[model samples]
Target: MNQQPLSIPADTQASLLDVLREQLHLTGTKKGCDHEQCGACTVHIDGQTALSSLTIAHMVTDKKITTIEGLAMGEQIHPMQEGFIA
Candidate 1:
């Protein structure tokens, strides 16, 4: 479920959450508290949970970003998303 990498222009100044949602159209991550106080927009950056709202797009230019959409392996759904099925 790895998604295609985004090409971040050097002049771009949006947060990782913005790029993930607006640019790539990934809506799994939510913006609960724009101040990074809440864990709503949590995602994996290089395999570790991170607050995407706090990270800038240019800072993660070549990093591997995995959202809820990428948690699954092949046809298997990740357990984190199973709750939505029921």
Candidate 2:
């Protein structure tokens, strides 16, 4: 398969968790085990909770991958995040 250049931020670490936390700066997604044992790195892939670490970076090509980053609009927080905080 031809590899496409995924536009993850330059400063992001190579790991999937690191990319989400550092580049996108979505700190809500925790990192309990880098081994993908714990469910802390859970995220919705095409509307299903998936272990982001197990997914290849290129697999998300042109697809809407919802991270903790894109959960909120300009000034609003996602209900899920707010519920956790509350």
**Alpha carbon lDDT of each predicted model:** 0.80, 0.65
Top lDDT prediction, candidate number = 1
Q: Which stretches of candidate 1 lie over 4 Å from their true place?
A: 1-3, 84-86
Worst 10 residues of 1 by lDDT: 1-10
Q: Residue by residue across 6-46, what tens digits does model 1's lDDT show?
A: 66554367888888787778898888888868888999988
C-alpha RMSD of each candidate structure in angstroms:
2.2, 5.9
**Per-model TM values vs. the true structure:** 0.82, 0.62
After aligning candidate 2 to the native by TM-score, how far in Å is the CA of 3 from where it should be?
A: 23
Clashing pairs in 2: none
Candidate 1 vs. true structure, TM-score: 0.82
**Distance from true position, residue 54, model 2, in Å?**
2.1
**What TM-score should be assigned to candidate 2?**
0.62
